[model samples]
Target: MDWRTKLLNPKQKARQDYKSLVTPVYRGSTVVFDEQSLIKDDWKQSENGYSYGLYGTPTALELGARICDIEGAKHTFIVPGGQSAIALVYFAFCKSGSHALVPHSAYGPNKAMAEGLLRDLGIEVESYDPLIGKDIKKLIRKNTSLIWCESPGSVTMEIQDVPAIVKAAHEKGVPVALDNTYAAGVLFDAFKYGVDVSIQALTKYIGGHSDILLGSVSVRDDSVYNVIGSIYMQLGLAVSPDDCSLALRGLQTLAIRLEQLEKATFQIALKLSEIDIIENVYHPALTSCPGHEIWKRDFTGSASVFSFTFAKKISGDQVEKFINSLNIFKIGLSWGGVTSLAVVYPDLVRPNKDFEGRLVRLNIGLEATNDLINDLEIAISKIN
Candidate 1:
C-alpha cells in the first residue's frame, strides 16, 4: 500500500494479449521506450513504426489504414479537416514558379486557396474546364506540378473525366489529386482510374454524423506517399484519436448508407427534373447533367448529392422563402450525413456555363423518401 509501490507499476503491463472488435483509442503524447537506443533521432510517420503524437496515434493510423484499403492506396495519412487534405497536396508537391491545373467546378474553398495561397506563393493556379479531359494536356507547362479534380463538381454537378485527365497529367510527369468527398471513395475508384492522390473530407461521409472534422490523403505509390507524408508531418497535422475512432465506426456502415443514398437521390432527382418549378437537374447519372457518359463509364455508382436550378426569372426572395419553408431538409454547409441539407449558391463559378436561374444543391440523407419529396413539393408550391 506504499506510494513507492504504486509509482513502480511497470510500463509493459500485459493484459494477456487482449483482443477487441474496435481499434483501441490510444490517447497519449509520450510513447515510452524500453531502452534509449530503440529511439531513433530521425523518426518518420511510417506504417511500420511510431514517431510522436503530432504525427499520429495508433487510432488515427487505423482509420488511415481503413481509408487506404477502401481507396486501394498504398499509404494513407489523416489530417484535421477536408481542406487540409487539399492544401497538403498543394504544399507537398508545389513550389514557387510551379503551376497547378484545377477543375473550375471544384469545391469553392479549394478555388479560393488556389487564388489566395498558391497564387501568392508564385504558383500559377489555373482553373481548367471540368470536361476538358485529355485536352488538359494543352494547358500543361514545364512547371506544371499538380492537377486537381472533383467528380460531379461541387454544387454544379458536372462530372469531370478523371481518367482522361489523369492520363494527360501522368504523360507529362505531373501528379493528379482529387477531392473524393462526394463519392466518399465508395461510388468511385480514384486509384483504379490512375489518380495519384485521393483526398477525402472525412467530415462529411466518413464521419456520417456531422460531429467530426477530419480528412485523409490516400496514395497508390510509396514515393507519392512519402512526399505527402513528409510535408504532412512537417506541417504538424494531427487528428484527435476520438475523431479518428468515430470515423472508423463510420466506415462500418458506409456501404449500405451509400446504397440507400444513391437510390433515394436518383428518384428525387428524376422527380425534380420533371417538376415545372425546376429549370435543370445536375445529377451525374441524369441526362441533364454534363459528362453523363463519362460518369457511367468510370464510376461504380451514384451519390446522393446533386443540384437543380430554378427559372432565371425566379427572384432571390422567392428562393429564400422556399428554402425557409422546408422542414426535413435543413439549411447547412457540407453534406454526407444522416440528415438532409439544402443550400443555394447565388453566383455560379462560371456564370456562362449552360445554367439558368438560381442554383440549389441538395444532400439527400437517410430520411423517408415520401417525406422528403413532400417537403420539396410543398416548398415549390409556395414559390410558384
Candidate 2:
C-alpha cells in the first residue's frame, strides 16, 4: 500500500530468467504477439497491453507504475524530454481557436512554444503574472481550454497560488497542468493541491544522475489520462526502455539526494541573502523569499534550484565576472544533477519591464556546503 511495499513488490515481479531485479533493458521495435487475436486486442488499448516496443515494454511499464505511485496518479505517460511533455499537454488539450493561459515567468522555452508554435497554430495564449493568485479568474475566457503553471516560476522563483488557480480553472471546466520539474513531486504533490496533470522532466531530479533524457505526465483523472494517452500514441512519443531503467535507478536515491541538496541550498541561499551585493534571495523556504507563506503552506520541502538578484550598483559585466570566478560551480543550463551548476542572469534572462532585479539561477548539487559557500563568497567578492 505504501511506496516501499509497492516498489519492493515490483522488484520481485521483475526477476525471471529473462528479466532481472532491474527489468532488463528491453530494446526492440517489434513485439511478437501470441496470435493475431491477441495483437488486435492489444492494439485496442496500447497502454494496457503491448503491441510493439514503441507502445511500451514490461520494463517501461514497471517504471511507469513506480512513478504513478509516487505521483498518486491513476496513469502516467512518458515522453522524450520535459519540453516534449509540455508540448504533448498542449497538443492533447488545446484545439485550434482555443485559448490557454500560462504564467508570465514560466520557462523561456515553454513561453516560446506558446508564443511561436501554439500561436502559429491559432491557439491564443495569455501570460498572467505568477503572483496573480485568485485574480486569475478574470483572465479565463469562454474559449479557454487549458491553464498551465510552474510553481516558483523558473526565473524569478515566484511560487504561484496553485490551489486558487486549480479551483478557478475547474469552475470553468478547464484542466490545470503543472510543470512540476522544479519541485519534482518530492516537495509537492500536485494531485493533493487539485492539479489535474502533473508534468515532470525525468531528465532532471528523477534522472538524478543526468545520464538519460526522459519526461513524464501523471494524471489523476481517468478522462484526462485517456485524452493525453491518445495524443501520446498519435504523437509517437515514448521513452526508451534503457532510459526508463536509468530513471528508475535514479528515483531510488531521489529522496535522500533531494533532502541533502535542499538543506545545503537553504544554507547557501541564507548566506547569499546576507551578502551586501545581493538584493534578494529567491528561495521559497527562506522567510525573506516573497512567496514564503504560499510555499510553506503548499510545499512538502524545497529543491536545490534557487535564484538571487544583484544590487543595482553591480553592472551586468560585473555579474559575469563573479560567475566566472567560481571554481566549483559550473556554468550550465540544466539542473537536478549531482553536480552544482550556475547560470549568469543576463545570459538567460531578458530584462522585462515588470521585474526589477538582475537574476542569477543556481542549482546546488551534492557538494560540501562549506566548500560551495567559500566558492560563492569568492565569486561574489569579485562582482564589484
TM-score against truth, every candidate: 0.95, 0.92
Write candidate 1's Cα lDDT for 258-374 as tens digits: 999999999999999988768889999998999999889988899888998898778777887889899999999779999999987765648466443388899999999999999
What total of clashing residue pairs does each candidate reach? 0, 0
Q: All candidates: CA RMSD in angstroms? A: 2.0, 7.2
lDDT accuracy of residue 124 in candidate 1: 89
lDDT of each: 0.88, 0.85
Compared with the true structure, the alpha-carbon lDDT of candidate 1 equals 0.88
- Candidate number with greatest lDDT: 1
Question: Highest TM-score: which candidate?
Answer: 1
| Colliding pairs, model 1 | none
